[model samples]
Target: MNGESKIKINMKAPLKERKFWDVIVIGGGASGMMAAGTAAKRGKSVLLLEKNSTLGKKLLITGGGRCNVTNNKKDTRTLLSEYKGNDKFLFSAFSKFSVEDTLNFFNSRGVKTKEENEGRIFPASNKAEDIFNVLYKYLGESNVTIQSDSPVVSVTKEKEGEYFVVKVKKGETVFAKACVIATGGVARPETGSTGEGFTWLEKLGHTVIAPDLALIPIALKDKWPKKLSGLTLPDIKITTFLDDIKQEVHKGKILFTHVGLTGPTILNMSRDIGELLKYGSVKMEIDLFPHLDHGALRAQLQRLLVEQSNKKLKNVLSILIPGSVVGPLLELASIDGETFAHSVKTEDRKKLVDQMKSIFLSVKGLLSEDKAVVSSGGVELKEVNFKTMESRVVPQLYLIGDVLNVDRPSGGYSLQLCWTTGFVAGSNC
Candidate 1:
């Protein structure tokens, strides 16, 4: 049948009919689709229900439209290390459906992948649509039934047997021998993640850890951050301090946002700051020249000043730093930008050296959850078996993706979690 014929047939089908499935996967996001495909391929009847008008809404926007499908790291130990909250719980799942398995799963489906810097794997076509298309095609070929705009209201386990009855918004019901909850966390509400999965799981007598924002930018207390917005500095060391004690230090590229600091260095330190913020105020120090010692930085500045003695102090600094930062550096050093380099005092020279080594900034709080890339806290891992992603309390019910309490550094780790857990749940379902 052609596309129009299929649409007519779907529209002609009666609504609110009872259906039975061997495996019913809720939330047609990354994990749900994977679970549905895997279960159907294993000869189990599967039904994939999505709340939105289409599937993979979040997947389409991932990695700025060029989906970072999975991390290239094959070592489970190294991959698990990137996860913060529940790294140990994923041991069995990763062992069964490892990163290598994720790469192979996509490659076999004709979605070619390439490993970028820091082990991030992206589709060679540089389009997230390719990944979504492959998954959609795989689901179709696997005979998985997909229903869009079907929001699950609740899931109740029948006391007599190992079956479940899932109720939808319009009072329609679907019965299944097993159910997999792949509903994502409440990070991107625009993509249909509104924390509904947590509520559903809670109704099923599961304890859910209150979700919190993660992988979001920090808001700074200082006004200078707004001025430096859009400016990016490479090879910078970011140190987080709580009550004058150094808490964590990360070295990478740093980007100045309108509110505070962002980029890889700041993102890696965000979870630490989020944890510390519960206690008291947190301070951050950025070492612009992390590779250079204080003495070496001072000598380098002195040499630049000596070589360009005829130029103004601001002009001399343009060589060491970007032109946009010259004014701010001079302001922090308490030196007039128009002052001649030859006339700079010893005290002012020391201040300039100090500013170049450590640029201080204060963080008030993190950006709102809506701006976060992924959420941190969710269902605690202790309640679920990592090997199958099945709930220990409720048999045959599995949880995967961001709904679980696990957050990792940027570079495709979060998506890998979805793929790994989804693969395991689908295989076991």
Candidate 2:
């Protein structure tokens, strides 16, 4: 589906006095659209406010536009553990509407989903448009009104009544009995997730945690990484060290970028890297053969040498490492890449094995928030009711999605949180 043609909201709808909607969901992202559609399904008049010309701007780019819908994990605790802060805060929400329910919701709407490795779910068509189409259809069928290009500026609660007044960019005041802040976080600002909801929540007596870039690429201090850009190393383990102390390790595919490192493994550990950077310089080690230890790697290298004794050392090493990364790996080990494999000394083989086992890179910093897949922080979890997603400080106010303080890795966990919180908020609101 064409991205522009989706989200059929009445863009030309004039701003005028109308009956107060039961719920006004600010931000038409994954969570906002879900909340609006679910509330409208429950017979509530809903208005979905989108800052962009279309809804689901961020959603369309999720999972490289295929949109990892949700994970297939049935264990609630295991699922919540993927998140960063206060995993227990989502117990009520996930218990109410889970990953299974998310899959069922889409499947029931004729959008078939399939699970990939690690329980990551994606549309059977491999098109994020399919997921958005399901939501757009739901919004249309539920009679949920949407206002595109209508960015909500501030939300103020009435002193004498239970209603809240939502002020848009043009100073138009839209009244609603309940307000759901689904505006998302600061990640991917081009997608309209600029963390505006954090400011609004802060103004309304909620503690807004300072958001940092999460699930994003990391900038490296070494220039060799730029040469290895575009090469993908699969099943490698990356360990992050904070001032020489090991903090975290992740194993998955890592894609080399012009600036630094990306892919699931690096993005998942980026939050820890961000924190580790604050204290001192951060360093990371890559274990190419994580399934094998040093002695086993040496044995494997020995076997490779015997198998390809006539080949150049670089060519022999290329069997274990990517062709693009082989030259650099040999250089780091101070070994001549052009040396004959059979003539290589045992000490040289050991150095090669050590370098292959623990490739080192000093992390310069993280990419900006706009480059992140999800922001690391949001409204502090203590201020919101996990059961209804309602704000404990402000009655009739609900915060969901990236607006909460939950941060999860890729592989469908983040979107799963969105689905769970969005559904729970919609069910209660």
Candidate 3:
């Protein structure tokens, strides 16, 4: 397949003139690009269609415009663990093109990459365009035909056989022997993932799961969190509870947003928070100083009061917390920041320590799909042949990326799934 001839086609001619193709891939995001290039590289005349004017629009925005190339997790089991309960279903696909393959696929092409905390990989230049350029070049070099801004209206099977007929809105109608549905889920509609693929799959006798927000910021019921918007705490512990019963605790970096809380920690727990919200009210207690006990924190605060007796309470507490957070936090604790540290009552001092130790907040709900990093639902896991990423219900039809109902957390797992599934689909199709 490596020495196969690359298909050359003229742009000026009608795309329908060719009439037939070896493969047709809908959607040109991360998985679509990888799948198209992989199939085309294997001597298939692959046509990649994207509704957007350009390919990889979503890819360019991933990881804040510095695309997370792949997780540095080399071990198959450890890497698959991040996929939640769907790990078992993914073993076969990952065995075909694991995380190491993804890293080598980019690194061998001269894209220098660096590993950040938590084994998250990114381009050394810190630009997502670098990642996109590599894929675009691969597709071009493989002679994969691309038709941008060509929104696919429907994908119907030719009544007689295994070939797929793809109809592009206001464009051309073409046929292919094999079709890969790489259209993503309903996460970021602005980037062309609107769940239209689910409809096409449903029409083809596949059961489509109702999509829900997965990795998204947590919205709060209280207004105090908004005051500290843009404030990022590097290390903190958050304990979640449902109906006054402690559920689980997670520790990670968190960012205060105008609406609520976000960052890696909150994003990772958003799905569980959403599940809790369905049954009962969800409450979260933030532990600003998880490493110290109550007595230890109180002792530290008492020492601070003695040392800064001449200063205002706010100024004294500023030594412990960030200066910007002193006033608002004091307000939340119902303490007078203007009081002199020496005049502070024992009860008031205890109140300050208590608030600092456990800041209470009510979880209103999870943010909507538009704010999500990835949506949860799609074609069910049992419906697809994970080894090949092909639909069991429809022959010659494959699914990849967010199109499958595999839920993964933030920090490189989602993109890794895209790479593995895309490669497997490309190899088998």
Candidate 4:
């Protein structure tokens, strides 16, 4: 494959005159771009098809445009724990192209990345375009043909053998010896991730998992949370219960939104929230002071009242909670903000302590799938070979990225899956 021979094509090209390709990748997200470039760099005639006007539309907005490339958790076992279900399927892929390999790949391409809190990596320039430019440059130098705005109308396998005929809109069909479906999941439809790949896989005798929202903001049923919108608590613990039974607990930052909660802790627990809602009623308790037990919190409150007898109750509470939440706390405790600390009855003080320790909120539901940061479902993992990212049910057909049923957390694990599986598929295909 050489730049002189490889050329970008459009739908206007005669269908019959289209060059047969060694590999044809559908979608131009992180996985498709990486797969096409990797295959082309290995001397394969690769064709990258993107329905969007440009490649890496979703990648441009990842990590709020900073693009968290990957995480620092280099150990495969520990990293696997961050995922939700069927994560063992990633062992082979992660082993082949670990986080170190990802960093090395980008570093070699001159996209210097820096590590942030929780081992998250971002480009030194803090621009997602820089990351995209690195991949785009690699694809160009490797002579990978790119086709933009050419949405595939249908995909069909030849009557015999391992060849695939990909038909695009306007009656254009291209042939390839191998095909990679990297169209991603239905997380962000605006980014061209409408889960079309799953439909194609299902037609090819593969089981497609029902896609749902993952890493999405949750809506609260109470109006109190809405009034606290834009307020961010640095350290808090959230415990989710289903029908009065504790299900799970997470500790981290929690941000109040117009409708509900959105932050690392809440988003991390959202998948379970969606699942638990089906079984029974879902409720979450927020511990304003997770570091202290109930007894310790009560004792601390008493000490605060003793130390500030002349101060207003609101002033005494302001030391423990943010000022924005002080008024709401007093209201929840059924105490006036202007009441002096010494005048507060023991029962009122106890109410204040209990409210401070555990504030409960009813769970409504999750946002739409398209608004999710990462989708939860796709082609069943058992149907694909993780070692090569090739479909076991349909030979010569591969699946990568969100099109597979691997649910990862927010940080950078999802993109790492794209890089790893895409590279494996490209190298094997």
Tens digit per residue, CA lDDT, model 4, 309-423:
9999899989878888998888877889899989989888888889988898999988887668888889888888899999999899989999988877888999999999999
The global C-alpha lDDT for each of the candidates, from Candidate 1 onward, is 0.84, 0.87, 0.88, 0.86
Ranking by lDDT: 3, 2, 4, 1
**Once superposed on the true structure, which residue ranges of model 4 sit more than 4 Å away at CA?**
1-17, 84-88, 124-126, 298-316, 340-347
Compared with the true structure, the alpha-carbon lDDT of candidate 1 equals: 0.84
The TM-scores, one per candidate, come to 0.88, 0.91, 0.92, 0.88
Give lDDT tens digits, candidate 1, residues 1-429.
Answer: 122222221211223453888999998888888888889999998888888878889989888689989888899898888886456788889999889988888899788889877788999999998888777777877888777788888888988857999987867888999999988998878889988889878878889989887888889999976888999997888788888788887888878888887776677778779889989889988888889988898888889989999999899989998888888888887789898989988888888878877888888998887777888778878999998899987899999899898868888888888888888999998
Model 2: how far residue 273 lies from native, Å:
2.2
TM-score preference between candidates 1 and 3, better one:
3
For model 3, where is the 10-residue window of minimal lDDT? 1-10
In terms of lDDT, which candidate is strongest? 3
**What is candidate 4's CA lDDT for residue 270?**
89
**Ordering by TM-score:** 3, 2, 4, 1
Off by over 4 Å in 3: 1-14, 305-310
Summarize candidate 3's per-residue lDDT along 226-336 as a digit string, tens digits: 888999988888999999899999998999999999988899999889889999999999888999988999999999999989999999988998777888789888998
- The candidate, 3 or 4, that scores higher on TM-score is 3
